[model samples]
Target: MCLLNLIVRLSYVDHTQDVSHTGRVVELKNYVRGLLLDSSGPLTKVELINHLQRLGVGYLFEEEIRTVLDAIWKGKDIEIENDLHATALRFRILRQNGYDASIDYFNSFIDEMGSFKACLCEDTKGLLSLYEASYLAFPGETRMDEAKAFAKRHLKDRKGKIDTRFEEQVDHAFELPIHYRMLRLEARWYIDMCEKDETMDPVILELAKLDYNILQASYQKDVQNGSFPTMYYRWWRQLGLVEKLPFIRDRWLECYLFSLSITYEPQYGYGREVLNKVNQMITLLDDTYDVYGTVEELELFTDAIDRWDTSAIKQLPEYMRTSFLALLNFGNDLGYDTLKDQGWDVIPCVGKLDEIARGDVPKSIQCYMHEANVSEAIAREHIRGIIDETWKEMNKEYVTDHVFPRAFADAAVGLAQRAECVYVNGDGFGRNQSNSEINGQVMSLVVEPIPINNV
Candidate 1:
């Protein structure tokens, strides 16, 4: 027969028993083994084919051999796991005898079938298969949008009356909460889209503004209804802003929850930045408490502050001198406090301030202290006061503009890194087209120029 026929016929016979089979099979196997032995770790399907051609296997079609090899390699119960493992085994053989027997026989079949898309689309269930493949191929926001757009178009074109329940379910999938407590989510998404996407359509800003108004209205209604206290506390807890307001014991858990969200969500830029500042504040507060306040006194103060009890501030132990000082500094920096006497929820603690000043207060606390404006002196004092000598040594100039800005920039960089890594794992279309498009949209939304006039 022909060379291909001879090779195929030889494959069925045991090499040990048949001299002719032994010679041909040994020669082909050695050739493949040698190719893999000399190279690096994993070769792609194309690389494997070219290597086979270079081996001078006249009868063996590289594509056909690749198909069989790939099947044997990827299958769990096979003698070898996959091409990488096969390549390793071949490498070992080459080191011993200057030949490799490892050849991927399944790649030829794949080449014959052409691209993954063509094979997927050739089936009778073309549309469903295509969608399923797309879902498997692209996930997260990219796939979600595609699926939503497809469903919306499909439903709109249908002549029959759509099932209202099914339609409601579809709408609910994309629905976001509109209450003031949750409006931050929408704001975050809008801000991220604006910053990250180069071609972010301006129309999205209109939607965001409308949503902001709705949330504001809801908040006002809740305030009038005397539900503001509960909702406000809950919001603080959920957004992790409560760590800065330690007196609010009822919402401590909520604060932790919000902190976790801030860590993960790139869209929560404002909240995230604020949370980092709050973390620094917390460290400073803790340091003050350790130096100037007893644990019992601090605990009691926390309870009193949450209750908005002005009198309890007077009852603070002699050791709890720095507690009120820290609180005052924090209030000044943030521009508002629940304890301000003029507000509806105010509880005047003026006398308590006198007691704190009597303690061993830092001079910077007196000079850099103001509620209206934060001077460079104040910023420097705060940074130096909190970061000890060791931490300063570990990361010199850690609080300078270069280092501090890293926290802010990390969200954008992290998103970009994740997108790039995920794209690398996928097909060319996903890598080149879909992921690039998504990244473009994200970058446009995040870094879009803000109109100075609007500000």
Candidate 2:
């Protein structure tokens, strides 16, 4: 599915003072800044930098982190790296941050048979670091390819054999690499993970908890009042799609999550709201086209969308009429705001990823199932294989291509990553989408505030 991009350019929340905790947060920020700027060793520095990022406060110290990583990348080739963990961590931080780190650094760990040194496998921490670093590989990087397979095979063999913290990490890496997780959600999970680590700085954990809760409060205010999406749910209720149509999922919260995942930085508040609206309308369109409409009715609906006018309203079915008018009003509202605020006129749109019922074309999984006459399991595997292959291509292209604005390219690629995270288990946007895993994820990231007293 294509991404919904709405840009009204604004500030991200990094500079927004969480007023209640202003003194405490400022104290923590300066303390952490000292830790970064202090003369820490390579291992400690990377660990601190990574903790800053996973804690969701890295953006506040971007210049510091950049200066640190830059010095690390350009310095003595990390000649002081004493083990696989340090080597892999250094390699990943450098390459991942757009430095031209050489793959040859891994050569020392490889033997004549092209396999990693067998002794290295016993170092679970090193293996995990290698596993994570391998994700930075561009296409044809055979060393990284081998590193991933080798590390994954051993990590599976050693699952419960590791410490609690590393074991939890290994389990999650298998479920979905940290590379592919939605950032805010991962930050939430990582806060708890760090809390359990004995070596984790209590100050950092405090900042993480307070920062996450503050951001969650801001996001919830933007999305809803409490458990319900009251902000624009009223606007949606006024449209009466859920009441009149009954088939479409009431997914205002999910749409907001999708928008938030796409543009999580606080500065993109306007863009996020606009994108949220675009996602909701697209969901309505997706449900209308995929689940309810007949081919002939869909033809009329598509035509109405194509015509993009008020008169086309009379042609749609009664339920479809409500959704169509909502779409038009959405466009008109966006156009009005953009014109009034920025002197530019624009409308919004989206694409569907699932099947279009019995009459229209089948999606990838459906086609696989129909062709192979296999169970849904087989079909899903085939489809995921396709997604994985395409991910590699996307991975390669993003690594090698440097022609566009990095932030824009990052957001473009992030849409695919975010979509994968959403549908990892199944249809995350389905009507009955309240599974515990998904719901807990939603609560942890965008809903429930972390109880800061313990941390």
Candidate 3:
């Protein structure tokens, strides 16, 4: 007879008698067996307890269930799945008669133990030892070792004697997660600033906003595809906005490394190599701007820096300070190099062509005329001087009369056209189009006009 049938039979001694505590024990065994059989595979201890509670089983003690499970699994009447850290057991009734008989006998032995821990205590360690064991069981999951190293610098507690396991767990959890979280928050702040800053150009701000949204969407897709954990993906998606904000890209990379340094031990050679590459990129960007960018470009750069303005330097976080200082030094070095390269001379002014043509009836605007086509250096120099002088006298009045009014009229016409397009596309007037289809159509209309004389 099978062990389950034997137990069921044993539960009722006389055929007419009332069912006793043995029947209750038999019922408990049957309950566990039924749950395991119904499951696709093995169940965790916690899952098994939850299953029993849900089934309305009375007098169900975790310890008692654990004891029965262990015995049934050991006798090969139940198969135990090998997990990463422990065995997750499942019952299979129709395996072997001898196995069933052995399990039935072992079940009685377990019952004599008075409680589940009487058997469990023989194999497992005490609370503190179990805490250490938990860390050892999954080294990747618990960064307690890293936390210990970090705490050592601040704590008076001696090595190997500090009772800060629980504290370390909590701290490590947030420490590893918070850096990326802050990066995301800061990225969002920069994106919002682009939209709201009065000094910022609308076109540039709109581009930054688009870049922010694209990176965020890509990060989220990667997370959903399981390339990273949801927590890491969510944090990284926020940080992805950093790339869209001017001057924050390098700072974001530094923050990324700072966070990594806590969870991962830096191998000296590899770590140094990566840091050197990052420094080189920063140097390259500095050189590119110094050699190529105009004063107007520098003004934009300065504005970006000023957006994060703070009175006290110490108020910035340590990692942020490190990143900002690196960028600041790069900008300062570039400024000095640019000044030296230009022989400390001021940038030459380009004057108004219309004003120059007003005083001297030149065939065409001298400023618009290319220097390359000028036959002699003397002629080029004379033309440039006349343009500058004429600009100093009448450039402001000419701009007020011609340029400002024309620009306002053109802008008004463009806005009206855009409004019509929006209305035709079933969108409200003045509502900014986000999709590429509408933006592309609007951009098509912004093409430079060909000369009417050529047409």
Best by TM-score: 2
Q: Which lDDT tens digits does candidate 1 get at residues 78-131?
A: 322333233333322221111222223223212353322233222222222122
lDDT values for all models = 0.35, 0.74, 0.32
Which lDDT tens digits does candidate 3 get at residues 320-367?
A: 444344444434544465478765522111011112212323333343
> What order do you get sorting by TM-score, best first?
2, 1, 3
Give the better candidate number (1 or 2) by lDDT: 2
The candidate, 2 or 3, that scores higher on TM-score is 2
**Model 1 TM-score (2 dp):** 0.20
* Residue-wise C-alpha lDDT for candidate 2, range 1-455, written one tens digit per residue: 10111011112223244686767888899999999999878678988888888777887798998989888877764444658888888877776556667778788898898889998878898889899888777656878878999999988888778787789899888888766777788888898898788898999999888778777766655543222234455677788888898888777667767877777776677787677677777777777777888989988888887777889999988878888788887888888888899988675332121122223346778888889999989999888867666765666666565778667656766677677787887777673655566566665665457887786
**Top-scoring candidate (lDDT):** 2
- Cα RMSD of all models vs. native, in order, equals 28.3, 5.8, 35.0
Lowest summed lDDT over 10 consecutive residues: which window, candidate 3?
Answer: 91-100
Global local distance difference test of model 3: 0.32
| Candidate 3 residue spans exceeding 4 A from truth | 1-125, 135-247, 250-270, 275-455
lDDT at 9 for candidate 3?
34
